[model samples]
Target: MVVTVFEAYAGLARRVLARPAWLGRTRLVAVDGPSGAGKTVFAARLADALARLGSGRPPVVNTDDLLDGWDDQLTFWPRLEESVLTPLRAGRAGAYHRYSWVRRRFLPRPVPVPAAPVLILEGVSVARAAVGPELSLAVFVTAPAALRLTRAVARDGPSILPELRRWHDGERAHFAADDTEARADLLVDGAPTLPHDPDRYYQRIARHPRPA
Candidate 1:
């Protein structure tokens, strides 16, 4: 099946630069959602779209690298602030190292993040679990449970099916009270999501502006 994608530089740019309150300047685009929601793929494509639309080309960051060894999961949250957020807020170039799961160590190479008009941070909690107040925009991607489960199993492997299920359960529980989804500026449908245009699989990322 041919996957559908939406990229409208003009429309996205206008929606992004919503008010005098914000700027295309130093924008942080955080793409959040559940696992198996295709956050990685969406981030890559969105970054490409934003680059084409905006004045300054934003750099992309994957929180996967900042992660602590699987043993101390999520410990890297503070590191993201120190390494990525601080420089972004300072309007300076920032550098960070990505963890190599295969090598079981962090690769020494640094991800040089420019303080462009925008920055794309794509991952599970690029916004939810981490601190990124400079986030000019935040998007949450969601899909049906069955579709997400199927995608997770297909991508990760059947052996991971149970583990992924548990992760989903935990995520739902965590987000329930926190209501990050409730506060989303946008909600993207991941798998088997639909649109007002029934024939269209790809919909412009839903735009619900934040009051701030």
Candidate 2:
């Protein structure tokens, strides 16, 4: 059946609300994908849809904001666990200092993450095997490698091209080792060719069949 973008997201919100809280008292949703796959945009829209569905505005903890720097990459998970996940797992509020890309350090004030009914974790490897058990929903967004690189350069600037290329390589290795895409409950096309409202609709991608 054809589902509108709004309907798709609202349906997902319903499914999430129906699930038991796996992260203390919160249902965690992980939006994982390679860089420039539009995970941030998708997560934001999903959060809005969830709010409209009566889940309230969920707090989105971006892994990028938790990273110490560009090199920190996948290693930033520990900080997130210690500062955020652990607290929430205990049915309490969590807080973390946001990292400043310009300063290359964490900011002074800590951002509070209340014990909301739902939480959106958006980043490259937030859906890795280690966090799989706690995830109520795992979404993988993707686009062609060339297109992704182009988008990254466009958003982050041509000056970041060199590091971005290395970053992409790291992401490919991480995704392969974690088998993230294969484990995702939903696969979204970051760059869809179909006509739809960008703010309210996203094109869903079917997962590739795995070999027996």
Candidate 3:
């Protein structure tokens, strides 16, 4: 039967919580994909699902907040590692400066990453090998290239297409080098479906409780 995105995530979350700990006290979930592959929306739903599963609302850290601009794609990772991942790994609240696109600067306000049972890091390259071992479950979400491009342009305006294209090339090379998809614990088809068994997603999680 057709299920809402939230319903799909509920099934996925149930299985994630049923597994063994891979990231110590905090379950680190990496939702990595291309720019327009719906990572943000999916992460939000998954956080809600985790809360419904009695894990309390999982704090989500968007890599977008860590990026300076188009050139900073994977380069902003180290900052994320230091401010967010490191603290959370040590079972403490993580703090980071949030970047402002308009001001072209990182705001002084610190974004907090609560040490919860589950934490979602959503953005491109989030599942890269650099942080793989620290992740409990790594999910790779994707859609048709043409569809993703279209969605990106529509969301960011046509003027941003050139930047988007350049970013895509970098993402492609990074994923290739990291073999992200091959290493993923789960691959999500980030496309709207008609009537289909959403439980299949649950089954995938059941089979691969932890990313290899």
C-alpha RMSD for every candidate: 5.8, 2.8, 5.1
Task: Give every collision pair in model 3.
Answer: none
Q: How would you encode candidate 1's per-residue C-alpha lDDT over 1-212 as one tens digit per residue?
A: 22345544345555665522232247777888887776776677666655566465567787767776544343566787788777766667788888886787888988787767677777666667344355677778787778888887877689866656677776686677557676677676665344443222234444545667
Residue 60 in model 3: shift from native, Å? 0.7
Winner of 1 and 2 under TM-score:
2
Candidate 1 accuracy as lDDT: 0.66
**Candidate 3 CA-lDDT value:** 0.80
lDDT of 3 by residue, 38-133 (tens): 778778878877888775988898998999887999999889978987787677888999999889999999988888788888999999897787
Candidate 1 ranges beyond 4 A from true positions: 1-10, 17-25, 54-56, 71-73, 129-133, 192-212
TM-score of predicted model 3?
0.86
* Of candidates 2 and 1, the better by lDDT: 2
Number of colliding residue pairs in model 3: 0
lDDT of each: 0.66, 0.89, 0.80
Clashes in model 1: which pairs?
Answer: 65-99
Q: Report the C-alpha lDDT of model 2 over 1-212, residue by residue, as the tens digit.
A: 32323236767778889988899999999999999898999999889888998657999999999998889999999999999999999999999999999988899999999989999999999999999999999999988899998888888899998888889889999999999998998888888877778777777876455767
Segments of candidate 2 deviating more than 4 angstroms: 1-7, 208-212
Report how far off residue 120 is in candidate 1 (Å): 1.1
Between candidates 2 and 3, name the one with more favorable lDDT: 2
